[model samples]
Target: MNKLNHDQLLSLEHPFVKIPVEKFRSSLRTSQKHIEKEIGNLTDKISEISKKSVQGSMEPSQVEAALEAIVNRLSTLKRKLKDIRADEVLYSQRTKVRLQHLQDFATIQTLDSDEYARWSRVRLNRIVIDYMLRDGFRGPAALLAKSEHIEDFVDIELFAQSAKVEEALERQSCAECLQWCKENNSNLKKIKSTLEFSLREQEFIELARERRSQEAIAYAKKHLTPWQETHMKEISHVMGLLAFPPETKCHPYKRLYDKSRWNDLIAQFRSNNFALQFFTPEPLLNVTLQAGLSSLKTPMCYQPEHRNANCPVCDPETLGALAMDLPLSHHFNSSIVCRISGQIMNEDNLPMALPNGYVYSYNALTEMASLNDGKVTCPRTGAVFNLTDVKKVFIS
Candidate 1:
C-alpha cells in the first residue's frame, strides 16, 4: 500500500479518517478544561493558605492541616494530569492506526489481500461492539471485543459508566446520574446544559408524586431555586406540581409528571455524556452503515426484477430497510458487482455470463472451475456449466 502524505489524506474527507480526527480534537479540549479547572482550584487553595499566614492566624496545627490539604490537592492534580497524558497516547496511537488504514487504501491493488481483509473484519467488529455497548448489550459486546482482541480500540469501559446511570434511571432513581452530573458539572455548565437542572426538577416532581408537599417545597427551595435566572419558567411549572396530584390532568403539570420523563432524562444524560467525551450520541455502527448503504443505493435496487441477488440495498430484511429512505448515489454510469466474489466487474476482472444467464466475475468463475473439475457453478441458481461455455460481457 502506498503512504499518503498528510495533506492529501486530510483532503479525501473519508468518514474513517474524519471520525478519529474529530475525536482527537474533542478529547484534547475536554482534557484542557479539566487541567485548567484543577490548576485553578490548586491556585485558589494556595492563595487561601497564604492569606491566612499573612493575617497571622496560621497556628502550627492549622498550618499542618493546610499543608496536608494542599499536598492531597497536588496529588490529585498530578494523577489527573497523568491520566490525561495516558489518554493522549492512546488516542494518538488509534488516530495513526486509522490514518494508516486510509493510506493502505490508497495503493491497494486488490481488496482480497489478507491485510485488507483483516482491516475490514476489525472495522466490522469495532462497529458492532460499539453499537452493542451503546444499546446495553454489554455481555455480547464484551465477548465480541475479547474474541477480536480489540479491547483497547473500543470504549467498553466508558460505555459501562453510562450503563450504570441508565440503569439507575430505569429504576426511577436519579442518584447515580446526579453524581455523574456533579462530576462533570463544569463541562456541562460550559455548554449551558440543562441536564443537572432537569434532574433536580425531576427529583422535585417525584417528591410531589409521593404527596409529600412539604418535602417537595423544601426540595424546590433548596435545589430548584438556584436556576431562577435560566429556568424560572420551568421551575415555576414544577412547583405547580406541588398543588396538583400526580393524577391531575393539568396541561404542563401533567406532562411534566408523565412517566416518559425518566426516559427523556436518560436520553439527555447520554447525549451530554457523549458530548463531554467528544463521541457521537448515535452509534458509530449506525452512522457507518447508513453512509455505506446510501452510497450503494439506487432506484433499481428497490425493484424486484432489477435487483441483484447480492445487492445490499436489495436485502429487504436489513440493509435494504436501512437504505429505504436514503438518497440514491449519484452515478454517471452503473457498476456491476459479482454475486459470487463480491467484487466489481471491470476489464481486469471481466464479467462472465454462464448459460443460465447469471453473471459473475471471470476471476470468481475461473477459480470455481479449477476447484470443481473444470466447471463453473451458479451460486444463485445452482446451475453448472463447462468453463469453455461462459461468455465475456462488455459494458459501453
Candidate 2:
C-alpha cells in the first residue's frame, strides 16, 4: 500500500468494487413499481370521476378540483422517485464512482485494442443509421453519465460516421439506400425537403467534375488531373509520337521551343546555364506525309498548315522543345539554359538571339524546316536520339 502510486492509491478508495447485479435489478424493479403505483392511482381516480359525471351528480368546479389533485399527486410521485434516485447515488458514491470507472475502462479497452477498435467504431456509427434504436439518450441514462471519455469517443465516432452519411448524400444512384430508408425509417425519417436538398447538392458536384474535363479544356489550356495527364502520356507513348532532336528542334531550338520558352529563359538570366533560347512546339506528324517537303515537285509546292496546331502525325501536338540541354515541352514551350549556344531558329525560319551574349545564341538547331520547294533548312549535327533512347533517361 505504501509503495502504491497516486493512481493505485486513489483506485484503492474505490477498490475496483463491482456493483452487484442484484442491486441494479432491485433498483429497476423498485423504479418500475413506483411508476406503476402512481399510474394505478390516477386510473382509479379518473374512473370514479367519470362515473360521477355520467350520473350528472358532480359539479364542474368539484370535478376540476379532483383532476387537479390527481395531477398534483402524480407530480409529487415523480419528484419523490427522482429524490430517491439522487439519494441512492449519494449513498452509494464509492460504488457509483467505481462502476463509472469500470464503464470507462470497458469503453477504452474496447477502443484501445486495434482489433476491436474498428468494430466498436462501426457499432457506434450505427447510431446514425439507427437513431430510433437508441435506448435512453437525454439525461443520466445517456453515454455521458456512464463514462468519462464518452464525449471524445462520440466526436471521433461521429466523424467516422459522417463519411458514410456524405456518401449517402452524394450517390447519384441512391435507389438502394432510398429503398432501405423506406423499410427502416429509424435513421432517415426526416423532413422531406432535407433529403431532396442533399441529393441535389451532390448531383451538382458530380456535374462540375465532368464539365472540367470534357468541356472546359477546349476553351482554356490547363494542367489535367493526374489521371487524365497519365492517360494522355500513355497514348503519346504508344503511338510513337517523338520530339525532334535539339539542333533541328532549335530551328533546332526554334524548331523545338516556342515564345514561352524565350520568356522562361529571360526569367532565369542569372542562372549558371543561361539558355540562348528555348522553344517547345508540338510533336511532329507521326504518319509519313504522302509527299515529303523535300519530294514535292511544283511551283514552290507546300501543304498548307492544318487548322489545328496538332502534330499532323499525332492529333495533339507531341511535346517538343529545343534548348542547350533537353527541351522543356513536347512542343518545346518550357525551357531552361542547360548550356551555352550560338543561335536558335524555330521549325519555321525565325531566329531568336540568346539573352546572354557569352552564351548568346541558342543552339541554332535546325531540327524542323521546310523549303519553299525542298529546302534543307534545319540540320542535325549530333547522333539523332530516338524516343526509345530518351525513355531510358526518365523511366522512374
Candidate 3:
C-alpha cells in the first residue's frame, strides 16, 4: 500500500469513513420510537382483551388468537429494533476507527528524543487544570487535580469563592462582592481602582431610589464621604438624587435612577476581583482562540489540500509576531488611546496623565495645549487642565 499523507489519511470524506455518529444515533432513535409505538399498540390490545373478558363480551379462543397476533407483531418489532441497534454499534466502531486513524496521522512523529524530553518537561496539563479552575469549571478542575496528584497546586477554596461572588453579581446583589473587595481593598487601591466606591455608590443609589432617603444619607456619610475629595462630583451628583422624587425626569438626575447601574457595578466588581486575584479579566484560552479564529478566517486556510500544508496563520516565524500585533484588549477601540491621532501609546510616544486621570499620547497633549494657547481640555472627560498639569507616565 502507498504511504498516504496526513490530509488523505484524515480526510473526513474518505470512502472508508462511516456516516457521522449523530446521524446513526438519530436513525436508531427513530427506529426505537417505531418499536415503542408497536409496543403501545400491543399493550392497548391486551388492555382491551382484559376488559372484554371481565365483561364476558369475548370468547377465550378469540382472545387467545388476538394475543398471539399481538405477540408476533411485538417479536417482529423487537427484531427490527435489535437490527437497528446492531447497525448503530457497527457505525460507532467505524467512527472510532476513523478517529484513531486521524489521531495517528496528526501525531507529531518527527520529534526526536531531546525534543520529546523538552515537551515532557512543560506541565501543560497542570496549566489546563489551572485554566479550568480559573474559568469556574470547579468540578473538572478538582477531578483533574486529584487524578494528577496536583491537589496541593490548586486553590479550590479561592475558586469556590470566585464562583460564589460571580453568582451574587449575576443576581444584582453586590453584598458578597463588597465583602470580598474589602478583604482585597489594599491590593485594589494599589491599582487605583474605583471598584469599592463604585459598589457603595450603587448601593447608595438603590437606597435613594427605594425612597429610603434617610438611610441613603447615612450610607453616604459613612461610605461615600471618605472618598469625597477624589469622587466629589460623583458623590454630589448621587446626593442630588435624593432631592428629586425617584420618578423625576430631570436631565442629568434621571440617569441616576437608571437600573443598569446595578449591572455596571456587578461587572466592575468582577473585573476588580479578577485583577486582585492576579488573573486577567478575560480568560486567556478564550482570547487566544478568538485571536486564532480572527487570523485564520481567510478562505485559503480552509481549502482541502491546504490541510496538509503549512498554514500561513500558524507559521512559526510569524505566529508570535501576529499575536503581538493583535490589540492588547478585545475592547481596544473603546480604550483611552490618543483620540486625535487614533494611535496607542508607545515608548517613543509616552502617555501623559491629565488631571482627570485620562491618559493621552504626549505629542497629542502637546498639540492640544499649543492649539488652546496654554491649557488643554481632555478629549475623553472634557476636563480642562493647564499645560503644567500634564504628567508623563512611564508605562513599563
Candidate 4:
C-alpha cells in the first residue's frame, strides 16, 4: 500500500486542504462549553467560600486559595475567548475563498456593451434604493444615497414620513397614516378612496374589542355614519357587531374581532398611500423577481433532457390557458381578455367597443354576430348592438 502525504489526506476531506467551517465551529463550541463549566464550578466555590466567610467558619488560607483558583480559571477563559475570536476570523477568510470559487464556477459573460452594463447598474441601484425606501429602511436609504451622491434625487423627508406611517400601522395604530390621508384629503377624495373611513372603522373595532362599546358606538356615529351612503352594507354589518358582546363568537360578526382585520387595514392603507403618491403598490425588486421567475418558467429555458422539455411555448395561444391557472386578482383590468372567448386584443384581433362600452376581441364579436344573426349583445351589460355600432378601438 502507498502512504499518503499530510496534504493529500487533508485534500481528500476538503478541496482547499483546510478544516471545514462546521468542524471548526463545533470545536469552538466544545471549548466554550468546557470553559463555561469550569467557570460555573469556580463561581459555585466562590459563593460557598463567601457564605463560609460570612459565617466565620472559613479561614484566611481557604479564602486565598479560592481567590487564586477563580483568578486562574478566569485567565484560562479569557485565553479561550481570544482563541474563539481568532477562529472566527479564520472562518470568515475561508468563507470569502469559498464564495470566490463559487463565483468563478457560475461566471457568465454578458454580450452587451459597457453602456448597457452602466445602464444596468443605474437601474439596479434605483430599484434597490426604491425597495429600501418602500420597505421603511430610511436610514439605509439615506446612507446609500449619501454614498452614491444621489441625495438630490431621493426625498429623505418623504421616505422618513413613509417609514413613520408604516411603523405606526405595524403597531396597529393608524395615527400617522391617518394624518397623511388627512393632509391629502382632496387627492384621496378624487380617487374615491375609503382609506379614512376604513381607518376609523379599525379604531372603532379596537374600541369595541377593549369592551368600550359605548365609545365605539359614539365613534361610529361621529365618523362612520357619514360613509353609510357609500358603504351601507359594511356599515350595517359593523353596526350589527355592536349588538353582541365584545367577546361574542358569532358567525360573521366574530371575524370583526380577529387580529387579521388590523393587518388587512394596514395593507389597504399602504395600497391607498401608494396610489396617492402615484407609486406602484409593489417594490420594484419584488416585481422584477416575479417577472424573472415567470420568464424562467418558460419552456425555452428548460434543457433538452429536462422533464418540461416537451412543454408548449409560452405564447399567446397558451396565455389564456395559463391565465385560468393564475388567480383572478393577478390579472390587471387593462390586460384581462374577453369573458366569453378568452382571447386578448391584438392587431389582428382588434378590440371592438359595443354600445355599452364593453370591449371584446373582434373575432369574438364576429362569432357572437354570427351566432345571434348579426345582433351582438354585451356579455357584461347585456346591452344589444349591431355590427354597424361595434367600432374598432385602436389601443396604443
Best by lDDT: 1
- Which 10 consecutive positions of candidate 2 have the poorest summed lDDT? 272-281
lDDT of 4 by residue, 1-396 (tens): 222233322222232213235435655776778787987898799789989999999899989988998888889878887877776666556555544443432342342545435544644665688788877777898888788765533446545756677778889997888898887788789988888888887888788777788898899999899998889888887777768766788966788777887778778877876665546677766655444345335333233434232233233345323432332233233553666687877777888888787778889889889988898988767888898898988776
Per-model TM-score, in order, reads 0.64, 0.21, 0.43, 0.47
User: Which regions of candidate 2 are displaced past 4 Å?
Assistant: 1-22, 87-396
> Over the stretch 45-158, how does candidate 2's per-residue lDDT look in tens digits?
999999999998899999999999998998888888887676455435645554554454444433345635554443344223223112213333234423533331122232
In candidate 4, which residue pairs get closer than 3 Å at backbone N, Cα or C atoms, i.e. clash? none
Alpha-carbon shift of residue 100 in model 1 (angstroms): 5.7
Clashing pairs in 1: none
Q: Candidate 3 at residue 74, lDDT?
A: 79
Q: In order, how many clashes per candidate? A: 0, 53, 0, 0
Pitting candidate 3 against candidate 4, the one with the higher TM-score is 4
lDDT of 1 by residue, 1-396 (tens): 533244542343344444556656766886788778877987887888889988987886897898898788778877877877777777677778776665665554445677656766877797788788888899999999898887655777777888989999999999999999888888899877899898999899899999899898888889988899988999889988878989998899989999999999998998898877767766777666777898889888988888766679998888998788889998888778888888999989999889988889999999999999999888787888999999998777
Residue 138 in candidate 1 has what lDDT? 91
RMSD of each: 7.4, 29.9, 23.4, 21.3
Worst 10 residues of 3 by lDDT: 9-18
Sort by lDDT, top down from the best = 1, 3, 4, 2
Question: Taking the tens digit of each residue's C-alpha lDDT, what string does model 3 give over 178-237?
Answer: 898887777788989998888788888889888899999999999999998899999999
